[model samples]
Target: MTAFIFNNLNDMQANINRNKLFVASCLSLLVTSLSFGIRAGILGTLGTQFNLSASELASIAATAFWGFPLAVVIGGMVVDAIGMKKLLVIAFLFHLAGIVLTIFAGGFWTLFLSTLLIGIANGTVEAACNPLVATLYPDNKTTKLNHFHLWFPGGIFIGTLIVFLFEKMGIGWQIQVAIMLIPTVIYGYLFSKLDFPVTERVASGVSTAEMYKSVGTPLFVFMFICMFGTAITELFTGQWVGVLLNNVTDNAILILTITTGVMVVGRGLAEPIVHRFSPQGVLLISAILAAIGIYMMSTVTGSMLYFAALIFGIGVCYFWPTMLGFVAENIPKSGALGLNLMGGAGMFAVSIYTLFMGGFYDRLIAEKLPEGASMEAYRTAAAGTTEAAKYAEAQLTAGPDVLKATAIIPVILTVAFAGLVFYMRNKKKPQLAGA
Candidate 1:
C-alpha cells in the first residue's frame, strides 16, 4: 500500500512538471512566432525609413531565415550533449539582445544583425522544444506536436493584431519590436525554474550512429526535398503577405491576421483531422488547398481576399507540425538531428526564396514601367502625374504577379504530396498483409 501510494504521488508530480514544461515550451515558441509576425508587419516601415529597395528589404528579412537553420541544425546536433535547458537559455539571451538591438537599429545592417539574432533564438527554441514535446507525450507525438505548434499561428495572430491595433494608435515600430520582450522575459523565467528531460532519441536508447545513419535514408532525403516546397508555400507567403497583398486589398496585414487566426483554430483541432486522414493524406489535401488558395489570392480582390486567405490558412495550418510529426512517427530512428534537419532545410529554402521573390517583385515592377524609367525617377515625379500613376499601377500589378508565381510552389507540393500519400498507403498495405 505504501509503495503504491508513493508511486502514484511521483506520477502526479511528474504530470505537473510536464504541464509546466509544456507551457514554457509554448511560451518560447510564442516568442519566435511573435518575432516573425511583427517583423512581417514592420517590413514596409523599415523599407521606407531606410530607403531600401525591395531586394534589400528581402535580404534583411532573409537574414533571420538564414540564421534559423544554422542555429537549429547545430542545436540539434549537440542538444543531447549540452542539454535542452542550456539551449533554451541561449535562446532567451539571443531573443533579449536581438529585440533590444532592433529597437535601437539605425540602418539596414543593424536591422539585419538583430533579425539574425532573433532567428537564432527562434531556431534554438524549436531545437529544444520539438524533441521535448515528443519525449513528453511519446504515445501521441503527432497530436501533441500539432498542439504545441499551434502557437506558431496563434502567436502570429496575436502579433499581427498588436501591429494592426498599435499602428492605429500611432505607435512606432520600435515599440512594437520591444513588446516581444515581455514574453521573452516570462519564458526565460519559466525555463529557468524547470528541469528538463532527455530527448526521445536519448531516452529510447537509440545509438548516435543509428540516428545519423537514418537521416541519410531515401525516405528522409525525399521528405527533406519536399520540405522546401511546403515551407516556401506556407512561410514565404505569410512573411510577404503585407507586400504581396498590398495592392490586392487595403487590409493587407489584416489578411495575415485572418489567415493566422484560421491556422490557430485548425491546429488546435488537429488530432481528429490527423487521425481521420493520416499524416500523409492530410499533407496531400493541404497541398491541394494551398495551391487553390494561392491561385485564388493571385486573382482575387477586396472581400474575396479574406475567403482565399481562409482557405490558404486552413491548408497551411497542418503543414509544419504534420511534417515534423510524420518524421517522428515514420522515421523514429532519425531522432533530434533528423527533426532539426527537416526544420533547417525548410527555413534555409525560405531564406533563398525570400531574396528571389523580392528581386522578382522588383523585376516585375521594372518590366511594367515605361522605357528608361526607374522606380526612383517615377517616385520623385509629382503626385497624380502620369509617371506617378504609372508607378503606382506597376507596384499594384507586381504584388499579384508575385502571388501568381508563388502559386507554382504549392502546385508542385500538391504533386509531391500525392506521390507521398500513395507511397505511404502502399507501404502500409504490405504491413497489413503481413499482420
Candidate 2:
C-alpha cells in the first residue's frame, strides 16, 4: 500500500493513456448524469400516480440525498485500493439494481428504499469518477471537468423528455425506470474493456494521515461549505418542482419540462461560462443569479415566473459540477480522497436539506392555504389562477406562496457562497504567488 501510495507520480502519470481515459471518463459521466435525471423523472411520475401529500412526496425525493456523505467516504478508499475500473463496475451494478428495485417498488417503504439505493449509487459514481476525470486531465482539470459534467444537466434534459414520451404513451412509470438499465448495462460493457487511472491516493504515495491533513485546510473547508449550499440549491429545485407547481396547475408535466429546460440550458453552457470567469468567479455569479431567480420563483407569478425559473436554472447550471471541478483541478495530488470529500460534502449537504426541508416546505406551503382545506382541494383551486386570484376568492390557494417561500433557502445559500468565494480567492492568491 505504501509503495503504491509513494510511487513516482510523474512516471505513473505518463503511463496514463489520455484517449482511452477520456472515452472511459465520458462514458462513466454519461451514466452518472443520466441516473440523476432518471431519479427526477421517476419521482415526478410517482407524484402523479400516488398523489402523495407534499411532505410524503418530498420525503421520497430526499431519500437519494442521504447516500451522498457515505458514498464519498467509501469511494476514497475504494478507488485507491481497488482501482477505478472495479469501482465503475460496482457503480454500474448498484445503479442497475437500484433501477430494478425502483421499478418494482410498490409501497412507501419500497419506493423510499429504492430511491435511497439509487442515491447511494449516484453518490459513489460521483466520488469515484469525478477524481478520475481530474487525474485523466491533471493539467486541464477545470476545463475537462466542466466538459465532463456537461452531461449531468444534459442527461436530465434527455430524461425529462423521455418521461414526457412515456407519459404520452400511457406507459407505467416502472417501465420508464427500467429503461434506464439499458444504458447502465451498455456502459458497463464499454468500461470493462478500458484502462482507468489509479487514484491519487494510490498513485501519489501520500500517507492517509497526510492526505487528510492536506485537505483539512480552512480553504478546503470553506469551499466545501459553500458547495453544500450549491448542492441544496441544485437538488432542492429539481426535487421540489412538481410539488411547487402543484397548486399552480394540473399540468405537472409541463411545469417539470419548463423547469428542467432551464436546467439544461444552464448546464449546457457551463464549460464556456467557467472558462470565461474561472470556476470561482462563475460560481459567485451563479450564487447571486440563483438567489434572485429563486426569490422571483417564490414571489412572482404568470409568464414572468417562467422567466424566473429559467434564471434560477441558469444560476444552478454550473454550481454542482463546477465545485467538483474546482477541487479536482486544485488538489490533483490528493486523488480520490480529495475528490470524494468534495462529492461527499456536496451530496451530504443535499441529503440534510432534503430530509429536513421536505417536511418543512410542505408545512410552510400548506400554511398559506385556506384553513380546513385538503391538499387536493388546494391544488384544484389554485390551477389556472393568477397571483391576485391566489389572494382573493381563495377556495384554497398555494401556488405563489410555496414557490416564493422556498426561495428563502437559496437566498441564505447565495450569501454564504459569496463569502466562501471571497475567502478561497484570498487563500489561493498567496499560494500562487509563493509558487
Each prediction's number of clashing residue pairs: 0, 4
Q: Distance from true position, residue 354, model 1, in Å? A: 0.5
lDDT of 2 by residue, 1-435 (tens): 444433455565676676776665666566665656656666645655665655667678767777656876797866777777777777787888888888887777888887777777777777777777776665566767766776676666676677778878988777767767776887788778776766645555556666677578776777767777787777677666655664554544454456557765665555677777877787878888877887776665567767877787787878777777777666544557777787788777777676666666556655665676565655434446653354333312344554455566667766666676676665643111101
- Top candidate by TM-score: 1
Cα distance off (Å), candidate 1, residue 29: 0.7
Cα deviation in Å at residue 200, candidate 1?
Answer: 1.0
Looking at model 1, the pairs that clash are none
Q: Model 2 Cα displacement at 34 (Å)? A: 3.6
CA lDDT of every candidate: 0.89, 0.67
Q: What root-mean-square deviation over C-alphas does model 2 reach?
A: 4.7
Q: Where does candidate 1 have its weakest 10-residue lDDT segment?
A: 426-435
For candidate 1, write residues 1-435 as lDDT tens digits: 545653454454464489999999999999999998999998988887887888989999999998999999999999999999999999999999999999999999999999999999999999889988987887788999999999999998999998889999999999999999999999999999988877767755578998998899999999999899999988999999898777667789998998999999999999999999999999999999999988888898889999999999998999999999998888888888989999999999999999998999888888999888887777556778999888778888889888889899888888888899888976742110001
TM-score, predicted candidate 1 vs. hidden true structure: 0.94
